[model samples]
Target: MTLFVAGLSHKNAPVELREQLAVEEDKLRELLSDVSATGAVRETLILSTCNRVEVYGVAEAPGEARAVVFRHLCRYRGVAYGSVEPLLYTHLDGDAVHHAFRVAASLDSMMIGEPQILGQVKDAFGLAQACATVGPALHTLFTAAFAVAKKVRTETEIARHAVSVSFAAVELARKIFAGLGGKAVLLVGAGKMGELAARHLVEHGAFPVYVANRTWPRAQEMARALSGAAVPFAELETALAGVDIVITSTGATEPIVTLAMVQRVMHGRRARPLFFIDIAVPRDVEGSVNTLADVYCYNVDDLKQVVEANIRERLREAQRGEALVMREVAKFLTRQSDVEVIPTIVSLRERLEEIRVGEVRKALARLPGATAETREAIEALSAAIVNKILHAPITKLRESSRAGSSRSWLPLIHELFGLGRK
Candidate 1:
């Protein structure tokens, strides 16, 4: 199958277009199932974040998979096909694999080396798995991409500084509280970024965690996973009063926590310092909440400065990460090229073996004086000779397949061996 990727990202499209194409967590399974049903795509995964909307898939043809994906995106977004075509970007086979690796490594992030995309990619794969849209090919490709990302993170200093929304939240909490240990962290919603931030806090020794969500079951699920307590959405004010830090990532169309709500909570705690991180796209906490005394509220845009600064400090490491991606792309390309020639080589080998066996059998019947044991010995010798003659050519064909130059040698091999005439 031919691998292909098509979509738009922060680098190629504005936030408006990206947001328009973004798929919600609840919608992912259905979207993937629909895309996979198109028959043009064999396996599919959709990665939809605030900064990008990418569809990765394998198909029988290169351009055909991309066309199918593009059409689906246009249909989902209600954008005219003609209007959306100009904004979409398509990558085929090797380039598609390279893009997936780079994205997982955060090399193509708005802030280079940011770590959030890795988790986002994982979530996408999970959804695809649940929808039965991912088979062995995609499973292998995604697992390898994750491995490469881990290698880049551990072997290089790409993540030396916090450069993602989630990491930035951790950094801000650190600056405000002097230390994360023994701090009370309240996660307002269980969105992906908020969950990631909560994990980071827990890693850094934050204790007595509390999670509140619109859905009590989801909140309880996250709480149980993190070994924390779950509070009802109605008790958000009470939960806020007890926590030293708050991270919000709800998907509300409007602000969930207002200035008045936070101010009311501050009264119960005697205005103790509280770090509020608003990582949601539409923003959960109101802008006015930042003005409250002893309340430090930071929005997504404000965090970008810290993320950008961290990216600047890791430029050297990022160069090394880029080199790794290039090497991986080369290796993936070689394998993909080899896949194309495998069937042809197998067919040719079978043809040759059939001819050799047929000739040996015909000659044995003509030898009337030959005994059974003699005929069997002659047949074995002919088989050995045929194997010895073809070994070098077979090995060379396999090697040529991997180098992506099989087309150049295929015609000559076919003519010399008369592979198909029989």
Candidate 2:
């Protein structure tokens, strides 16, 4: 069977297209069920993140599997298949293995070396297994991918910097102020990344002016714990004008902070300058808001370029990680090849042993007057001959796997040894 991965990522599509296809964890099982029902996939995984939507699977034909995956994504997103067909990429066999390893290693991230994708990949794999969409093929693929990612993490300095979108927002905020000290900040969501960004702001000496969440109690508790005043969720736009920095990570599907909303807030500030960091996947702030005067808006994808400054140093190490992935893939394939020949080798050995034992038994039966020592010697002699006779062909069959050139000789060997269907 051929292993394959088919999907679209940040390299081929913008966030506009990506968000349209993004599947939440709640939809994972349903999506996997539909994909598996297509009958093209033997094993399957759907990895849906902010940056990508990919399906990895094993099938007899790679093209058919890729088509099934692409069709599923289009159908799930309610988009025309022709519209996204050009954007999708498919990798088969070794290339598919490389894609998986690179993705798990975070090398394929928009912000290369970012650590979040590794966890995201793990979560997708876990979710697929939980849904029972995965069997040994995907199991082997993901486990190897996880191992490669771990090796990259422990062996490389790529992720030593806190260079995620959240951290990038804080860095941009710092560029605006000589320092973050005394700056008034408003954190709009209690999202994990947003909360992390708030902590970083506090570290940089910025003061939390407001914390507003959709849930009032969470906003109140977060505000109190962060030493900031809680604002009613309805007054989010009102809170925007007063704060120097706004970080939003709301779960809203559409833009919450639109250009008109920012324009209304900017009027009250009188060109005081408002900085917005929207770290949400679907993006809380409107894309057009970045065009507003005296306003700086940065979204998750915008952080991609910001991360490259530190990433230049990690390229050499990434090459080493790539080499390691290739090596691991080779070893895994070799082992699989070796496993395929085991039954044939066992059958051949068993057939020879049957002959040796039968002949020894016949000789023992004919020698009723023979001593016990003589019978033992005859049995030992027969066993030794069987082992020596079987050794050469077994060794050759096993070694042939490493060279990957055994298909022609395997059937011939089986026929020559009269080993089949037993």
**Best of the candidates, TM-score:** 2
lDDT of 1 at 237: 87
lDDT of 2: 0.84
Candidate 2 clashing pairs, residues 3+ apart or interchain: none
For every model shown, what is its TM-score relative to the native structure?
0.57, 0.64
The window of 10 residues in a row where model 2 has the poorest summed lDDT is: 157-166
Candidate 2: list runs displaced more than 4 Å: 164-309, 368-380
Give the alpha carbon lDDT tens digit for every residue of 8-43 in model 2: 999998889899889898777887888788888888
Candidate models: Cα lDDT each: 0.85, 0.84
